[model samples]
Target chain A: DAGVTQSPTHLIKTRGQQVTLRCSPKSGHDTVSWYQQALGQGPQFIFQYYEEEERQRGNFPDRFSGHQFPNYSSELNVNALLLGDSALYLCASSLEAGLTSTDTQYFGPGTRLTVL
Target chain B: AQSVAQPEDQVNVAEGNPLTVKCTYSVSGNPYLFWYVQYPNRGLQFLLKYITGDNLVKGSYGFEAEFNKSQTSFHLKKPSALVSDSALYFCAVRPHGGYSNYQLIWGAGTKLIIKP
Candidate 1:
């Protein structure tokens, strides 16, 4: 059973440029969530996708958006990126429980985005 | 407001010594807590979770957490520290009843260094 997987382990972009990070959830998982972790900080919730629709979002702006494919894979798109966007973008997957209170999220290696 | 806090920025311990990473949380109702670890340049790994039963929850890599309802704390503990166990430890809490899209509230993270 493969765990969550992400692509483009590292990326570089300049301010105002756009970037897309990808993630494949673990087998048998139906929900995907995105998070951003800056240096020396804990991860902040970005948003969560369930049944191909955004079920919940955090305090992020409109520039940060995501999509969940039919296969349960996900993509996080950041538009008009800024230097402050340089951080580790993490993707986590979990089984879709009616109540996620007990769900444990499996994470991928994450993409390191460096916005210059 | 729901939140998690890792008061210590970093913790240093000698190999073979037992170690503990502190975490405290505040939420409106019963708190669903979790512990995750991240190695250098890697994604966060689920260590353990606390839901309804068992105040002491054991997880991967011989990690365990004790949930104290009175103190509202869930502290990660290891029997013996290993250099390989050194990593960034994070504490997270699921909002009461997972009503808010199951987004997790995270702490600032604590860097653990096990000296060999």
Candidate 2:
């Protein structure tokens, strides 16, 4: 089966503009989570969606939002993008909402966002 | 709050030599530890996880990680390094049990380089 997939492999946006990145979770997965990875840094969790509702969120500001579709696909939206927003946006999928300690996450190729 | 730290910014090793990437974590209660690797322009790929059971956990791509509860450390190791294995490695942790959300706390990442 196909792994998690993300759209807009590369995107360029100007400051003050908004952008939306899409993701299709792995087959048979339901929960979707978004992460942002800046240059030379590990990914920071943005938020997680389950059952078409946001289940958990990280320390990110209100500008970063996400939605989960019925098909378990997800979209990450960032408003008023800044130069700091330039990073690799990754999407991960898990089998369930309340993950056990052993639950593993599968990731997508990610979308590279460049804020110009 | 949960957090992870990859002490080394980068590690260099020769091909055919063993390699190790160090990681330490801080979390309330028991921690679920994970290791992920990211190639250039790609998302993070899950390598291994430590929930309970054995301290030494083997994972994909011939990677293995040792979980040390007393030291709060989980170090990734490979028997023999290859040039193709060069990439950014991340360590993450999440609290186990008792109202713990499955949100992961990530480190800044460590870059591993294998020379021919």
Candidate 3:
């Protein structure tokens, strides 16, 4: 009954650098989503992965990409990181029953990213 | 565009007092509303959600939300606040039915400070 888990509790990078954050979704979940939360702000949606393909994405630029493995784990990759990209990267998992199903998403302890 | 609003930036209350954090949403049709809490340096934790059924939905940590359809509001409530309840609370929304989009529109978040 393990919940969603994320790797590298914290990370530090510089401008023009790239980083990858990992996420293992909750047991019995298949869909994974990424979000960014700045200090004192709510989370902003990054993108969602279902069936090993990116299903929907938010307003984020192309520098942000992700991969969902067959085992339902996910990895978020950010290239050419900027100071603005320094924030808490959150990973959430949900079960996609259907187009109309309202599945509650469970989140993992976010990975804090600091772009130096 | 579908959006969620948490009007208050912060709220302060003494322990043992009742508390409320407001959330409003704008969506084309019925909305799936959710409430999540985040402690300092932690990720978001699901509190409660409103899909269908009763207007009064209870969730973790003595939290309950009343879904008002006419008002398009889902306000989180607690009978008695505790010092440990101090944290940042977020409200999120997704348009219900007729769509495969699982993206959740998030609010700016409200900080709650429960003084002992």
Candidates' C-alpha lDDT: 0.92, 0.90, 0.93
Estimate, for each residue in B25-62, the C-alpha lDDT of model 3 and write its tens digit.
89878888999999988888999999899999999999
Q: Candidate 2 — which residues are off by over 4 angstroms? A: A97-101
Task: List the candidate 1 regions with Cα displacement exceeding 4 Å.
Answer: none
TM-score of chain A of each: 0.97, 0.96, 0.98
Error in Å for residue A76 of model 2: 0.9
| Model 1, span B1-116: residue lDDT tens | 77898999999999999999999998868968999998888889899998889899999999999999999999999999999998999999887663564888899999999999
Best-matching candidate per lDDT = 3
TM-score of chain A, predicted model 2, versus the true chain A, to 2 decimals:
0.96
**Model 1: per-residue Cα lDDT over A11-93, one tens digit each:** 99999999999999999999999999999889999999999999989999999999999999999999999899999999999
Question: Which candidate leads in DockQ?
Answer: 3
Instruction: For candidate 3, give the DockQ.
Output: 0.82
Q: Which candidate wins on TM-score? A: 3
1 against 3, candidate with superior TM-score: 3
Question: Tens digits of per-residue lDDT for model 2 on B48-91?
Answer: 98888999999999999999889989999999999999999999
Which docking band does candidate 1 fall into?
medium
lDDT by residue for model 3 (A1-116), tens: 99999999999999999999999999999999999989887889999999999999999999999999999999999999999999999999999876687899999999999999
List TM-scores of chain B, every candidate: 0.95, 0.96, 0.97
